[model samples]
Target: MAIIKAVNSKSSIGTAINYVSKKEKTEEKLISGIDCNPITAIDEMKATKELYDKKDGRQYSHFIQSFNPKDTLSPEKAHKIGKEFIRNNDKFKGHEILLTTHKDKKHIHNHFIINSVNYETGRKFHTTKYEYQAMKDKSNELSKDHGLTVPEKTKEKGKITSFNQNKYRVMERHFKGTARSYVIDTALAVKKAQGKSTSREDFIKEMKDQGYSTNWTDTRKHVTFINNETGKRVRLANLEKTFNDSNFTKGGLTDEFEQTLGRRERSRGTKSIDSRNKGVKRAYEELHQGTDGQGLNQPPSSLKRDSGDRRGKQKGTRANDFDIGRAKEHIRKSASENARSLGELSKPDARTRKIEQEKARELERANRRELERRIERNKSRNRENTR
Candidate 1:
């Protein structure tokens, strides 16, 4: 089986080009370079992109296409298949590429460093979900043509093992028996805890008590446990399917916790709104009493000073002091309106509604500033008239 994976190159294109085309891995440049010197080819590719003003942050698409270690294909044959795969694919056409095969590992894998910008069209390559599928299909086709063994396809899609899995596998294969033992022991302990604990918090606490540290949070998708002594972080989901966070929900542990958490959050939110509404009501009443003893039924405009007393008040109370009081009244009204509006939003949609609430507050602030400016102008005009 051949697996292909693409990585976006953020570092220097020349550096990646050199690393893949190194003499030690590529048999002293004999097994490297497609049409020209690999380094020169990449430099020219970059220059071509710059000439067309298509140079982007992503300089290249680095791909690793590896065959099964058990496969008996030669390095030269594997390199040819990789080159053909890139040439035949419509997604990689008209692009400068460097191909190299490494013999350092048990499996024969090809590394491809292709320019992002197409030399002919000056357009960058677009990646999609189907790209990996296309690569695998092409690889399988080429393997069949070369009389190589092709793994049978199953009705159920197999899980793709992650790089971390392979890394740990190598460590386990070598002499790191203690680390491997720690991982297995921790996974078994967590599984046992999952069966007993009714809530996620309880399970995590139990795991910590048993000498494992959990970094699982409500925001995280997966739970990770670190071995306290070894400091090795292992993803619970990666260890076994039954130990995954999704399984906890299926087994009724996380579901119960989530429902309980939701109710508590809603209760807290309701109490917060009630407290805020009371504060707003008290502030509104104070503003009404302070502003010339006006009633609550009167509009904000009615709080303006009389033309005769404006000059006297302007001397006694600074324009800023009057504006501050008016601003406070506006804030209280805005808060009350926002609180009522939020109360109508569904609990599930409260986060989205908060953005709208912020926009409304900004609009209210703009109106308040304009009203304050008008009040200040009126006071200035009254003072000049009195002069």
Candidate 2:
């Protein structure tokens, strides 16, 4: 929902920068009753002005606004997003970008004023119509990332086109695909309107009236039909070309062709989340059973647990003092038995004892031999040190 309007200024880059900043601050104060943090200031302007001296620091002005996505016109959000937009676009690097909020409307809308000169190159930064549209797309993207409510596609303005209901129906019925309908209708309409044989000028006028456009091909050999709103174009065959080449018709109706013929509708149109919520609740009821018009007839299971009487009765199966003492005594006796098993009282019987003693003796002998080897090594080290 964000809108972009660029202004070409005939002022110094320093003057333009200061003017834009002041305008932004004034608008922000009027709308939000607060001063903006004022991102991208005059010093940045001086740095930029230094780069493209021949461009005279400012030959053009760019006004950029990033509108609030949730409402498309929130003043606070507009101010915030607009600043971010300039901060990101490299074209605004050396130029002054003034971001402002407009408060005179029900929805928040903001504006950006930018100087067109590039500090590195004296050339102007060129922004096309598509780039402006892209700015709106980017605004929506930032809104979604911030967890703000995004307006459904249905609420957006569809691309503009000339074809209306009657024309669309005529094209749909007569043409095998979209192509035949548009080409045939256009041809037949031109033929029927001939003032006994209309002149080319008259034919072009009639086509324009019918919401068709005319543009010449590069060689000026072929005529093209266009949709004014979307700027989509389609090439039409001259009478001679149509008759001379059979394959010319084989191109069929492409998406581009249909669009030029105004056969396209915006796909973004979708119900907003708030509007869909109520319908979802109603749909849920018809699919589920055991419900009164008001609510469930029986109390839910959770309510039964909170009734109190059952819980009180369940708590009565408690252990007595005698039972507790006996349990402790049982645990102590088991621990005592485990201790004896690991000590003198639980030593193995004769044959098993003899095997363990033999194993221990062999281990001791191995240890003593290793100790004697260590002592011999130490004696050899002492003799070397004495020498």
Candidate 3:
């Protein structure tokens, strides 16, 4: 699992670049590198960017891509994924990017310093929610391709803290052993309360009596419980699936417990009857048998009636009927139309293609002029040497 975050820093571009491209965190300057001009380094990149965009906004956007600690990913692999993630984004393309992997923490994470302006076009890269989501999607895709665990995708808006930050926060609060242990203790308390309560309100009251406050209001989706002692709160759904509201309703637990007891009693009774009437051919007949008298192998009459009704309805339906000839003609027409549409969409616009071609011609002509100038300079130098 990879967690990607874009932090728009208020500091200068040089400061942000120096922070991410530090040599100490990157194994004494072994793998820390940049994707900008080979001739110029971070300073020159920053200078060029400042010369182009003199806006009073964020200097650079810092992106942190962290992988799960449990994943056996080396620093090189993580850095490669981070670089690929930056390159894949259309906004980050043609811009100077410096990245380094930090091994200071338990997990391997990459810090990227992206220049706000594109060196070629001088257009600023605007960060948006769509861009963040695309980065996350690309990270997960790369993680899966590398046989790593994919994190659960959440639709919740706003900034999400990293896994380590949340863990440290919970620990800093001085909660019992861990959050999981607290959840287990709370679940046991809820179970004990369910045994004595006859209604949902009574169950909640029982829990409150045991120093746990619940937030099972109509507005809240999950049943959240707060421990009065530790002042820690956790949603019941996060503890376990069975602790959810659907399964932990009033009288629901008691009814399930009773049904389990009834099944045990029936099994014991069946064994006793079998032991006493071993000589009889239909020893199980005395039990409540179905039409086949084979115990529970056959379903009850009501279930059989429901199944028959469903089968009858399915047999009478004509939704599956179709004309093969007409269907073939329709499929051919649809296929032809889709192919034509795809071809038209795949082709570049004529006007844009013409402009790109003209730009390429201008670049070639400029390169020839520069080559001729260099040759003239060299010839003049040779004549001066002969003199």
Which one is best on TM-score? 1
Candidates' C-alpha lDDT: 0.65, 0.47, 0.62
Write down the RMSD of all candidates, one decimal each: 22.1, 29.2, 22.3
Model 3: lowest-lDDT 10 consecutive positions: 153-162
By lDDT, the best candidate is 1
**How much is 269 displaced in model 1, in angstroms?**
33
For residues 1-387, what per-residue lDDT tens digits would candidate 1 score against the true structure? 676665544678888877887767767533544433453566566665654566766787788888887778788888878878877888877676778888777898899888777766778875643565677678778878877765443221222222234444543443334544555566566656665565777888888888899887878877788979779888765664322122333223454455556777899999999999999997766554533454455454644643557656444432223445677878999999999887777575786778889999898677656644543454355345435
Misplaced by over 4 Å in model 3 are: 28-34, 37-40, 53-55, 154-387
Q: Lowest summed-lDDT stretch of 10 residues in model 2? A: 154-163
**lDDT for each residue of candidate 3 in 214-310, tens digit (9 for 90 to 100):** 8877676678889999988877655433222222442234444454466678999999898777846454433334333234343478456646687
TM-score of model number 3: 0.41
Evaluated at residue 210, the lDDT of candidate 1 is: 84
> Model 2 misses residue 53 by how many Å?
5.0
lDDT tens readout by residue for model 2, 1-387:
444434444566546545544553446342210111134334443434434343343354545443333453445656666666666665456444445566654555565555454433546765544664565566667666655444332121222111133443544444434344445444544343332222345546766776777664346756676756556555655421332211122121121233333422333224355458778876554333222222222256634653645646654321111344445787999999888767754456755887889999898677656644543454355345435
Which portions of model 1 show Cα errors greater than 4 Å?
Answer: 28-39, 152-154, 157-387
Q: Per-residue error at 305 for model 1, in Å? A: 56
